[model samples]
Target: MKKKLAATAIGAAMVLSMGTGVLAGANLQEIKAYLNGSITVKYNGSPVQLQDEQGAVVLPITYDGNTYLPVRSIAKTLNVAVNYDGATNTVLLGEQAEGVALAKDFKNSSYHTKDPNLTTYGGKDYKEVYFDNAKSSRSSSFMLYPKGKYQKLVLQVAATGNDIESFYVQDSKKDIKLKTTTIAIQDGLKTIEVDIAGVEELFVHADIKEDGGMFVPLTTSYFK
Candidate 1:
């Protein structure tokens, strides 16, 4: 009978980022560890394949009587986001870390209009704005790919005229609506946050009154 080493997933919920380093002046203990290539990982009855950021297979390591696996790979498999603060040598799990600016990461494009215009309001310039023609009640949408790296989407929205109707957040890959809300132009600017856990692709949709107006959704921040 071959003795197989089993690795216990320690701190799988708190994963270390690829760039985070160990604490300073930490004592290092050297031990003889074995690399186990023939290990299977499973979740709920489903098998989980472990791979690095580059899609390379990562093996489990067995030291003494315990087995260890890569933290980032395990976190991703569990549908959790991992962030590291290099300045403080901290590992943040889920949405505990700071938010990421969406504009720097996501691509902007028009969904219904022939051309989307960039507008400014309250002394702040917005790059993604929805322009509606008064021909009919219409909607515009844009997409962002989170790939399970973010947990929430935070933004503020407002309409120039009385054409504000509704806002929706949908899981584009699953074709499911996660959240939706109606907006009133009299409310001025409205702030909203949507849960986006484990979502591969997300769609933000805005419904207008077709009264020839402008709708602006600002602040592209996401929690990781």
Candidate 2:
């Protein structure tokens, strides 16, 4: 992945008058409830929702007749990365990769066999998610949905003791397939990178040996 430059945002501001006298031990920060105000944010034509700890709007505060909204909250709703420099009292905002967070992955009913212990199927004790074809030539698939813009579906897959002959994303029309030089893991899943751009609905399908194929899972995320 290529790195992008980060943006910076300020949270709050304080100003004092020349005539004001300050005491060395006196505190200056104060908090008060604000009402009768409106604030809205949007991203990609979609409303960016912002909420407070109590699930209420993190309203803009009026201090010294100036209104301000929490910068961190606004950045988060837009999926922007944020970092704070306490020494310099700075807030750094950068490009953060928002991935396709899996809520639920639906699997097909046609699997050759099922095993809880992945070590039996392969060699690793890692958890097994889905298998394409281990006893038959049939194709098994899993349907998934991811939002926002992405270039491909990232998968960590391994088959038997050797790499599978064919593996592809079956939900889209484009010829998306796994391209990797790493051989199949004898015990764990290997990262398989493939192009799956412009795909909102994902169908990941794979075909391994009819007699000795049980794909194991490591981790799955989106890549752009």
Candidate 3:
């Protein structure tokens, strides 16, 4: 992914400030509550429905007893511009404003698949996997282990184009089949929670329907 020099610099500065008392620490629930009351979100100055008035937003469940707000909503509320690169599935949210408080409890961690060939499926390549677009492509299958029981299954799906469609837990030995789904190419990042029973080795497969091609990226720390 090409770096936006300006955004990169800003993000770097924010990261540094995280430890220097610039950013506060809090839990996911606390951050959600704060966001509920503190900011109103507008996409391109138009109100967007990412959360509710009572702060009862349906967020992706994570392992650490935290919740992830949609990146788009947070960026808009914080007055940062967001961009996504379809070819790479790379999302860039412009820098946060000075003195703006970010969710103190949420830790930014990288979770990715290692198989280079795993990106493309059904004659199409999704440059990166996102929590928002997980329901695309019925042929795609990914695994999520909860903090411990049985790992959950996040299959590439096609429910409603707007919602996170379907998610559930499954035994390791079960053979799972995914439904087909597709998403329009867009620039932005989406977060999702994968329930891993425990900290165990998890595998996700991105198999392109055409020619039965498969590419797998190395699994990193997935949330929930």
Candidate 4:
């Protein structure tokens, strides 16, 4: 991404004190901030191009040994909605929806696929899921922090090359198992839905009977 100077230095101040502290009152003030063109932002191993409202390239600002970037630009780039509430001085990123999140969208996952490729089954496009860890343990899992906002969980598991025994959902925070379902390749793809209302930390795991390149392909995983 190209690095260009902001239209004014206050641009940095606006971002530096967005929701809390100085800028919450929306009073005009002058503050010294430095524009460091050398700083580069990479999201998920890919370089991000930061820009401003007028399509001008924007660089990160350094203030009191802290660096700040344009949140609107970055969030929108990642396909997340961004909104500014001037009355409350609040910045909202993303919206509430029945489909709260996708499996590939979660960053706090363990022993699971990182870069999922588009795979098709049953005339539907699905993201292929594979275990990063070996098959000896016969399981892989991901962590989700819903913070009691969502009420439902839905996901599909399919076996492309081998049979999957089961997958389960759990509230890791409270050490409670929500639900579990068995997956049989002969039965085709299986959809597992569970009630997750008031769940804080959700744990989803898949148990495979055998290991293969396409052992457990998750067609869809989302929370409602």
- TM-score versus the correct structure, for each prediction: 0.65, 0.41, 0.20, 0.47
Per-residue lDDT value at 189 in model 2: 63
Best by lDDT: 1
Worst 10 residues of 4 by lDDT: 8-17
Clash pairs for candidate 1: 7-67
How good is model 3 by TM-score? 0.20
Model 1 bad stretches (over 4 Å): 1-32, 37-47, 51-57, 83-92, 110-118, 122-136, 163-166, 212-214, 220-224
**CA lDDT, candidate 4, residue 19:** 44
- Cand. 1 TM to true fold: 0.65
Candidate 3 accuracy as lDDT:
0.32
* Better candidate number, 2 or 4, judged by lDDT: 4
Q: How far out, in Å, is residue 169 in model 1?
A: 1.6
- Summed backbone clashes in each candidate are 1, 1, 32, 0
Ranking by TM-score: 1, 4, 2, 3
Model 2: per-residue lDDT, tens digit, 1-224? 33222212223432221113332334556567453145444445455555542356655556555555565555445444344444444455542244442323434455422456532343444343555445655444566553223455567666763456555654444444434343354535666565543344666665555554645352243343
Choose the strongest candidate by TM-score: 1
Ranking by lDDT: 1, 4, 2, 3
lDDT of each: 0.62, 0.47, 0.32, 0.59
**Model 4: per-residue Cα lDDT over 1-224, one tens digit each:** 44233322223333522545536467667779777888766665667777754568887788876777777666545544455556756665444343744554566434344344435566655554533334454666677776554556776666645665666789898889999776676867667777765566888777654453223344366666
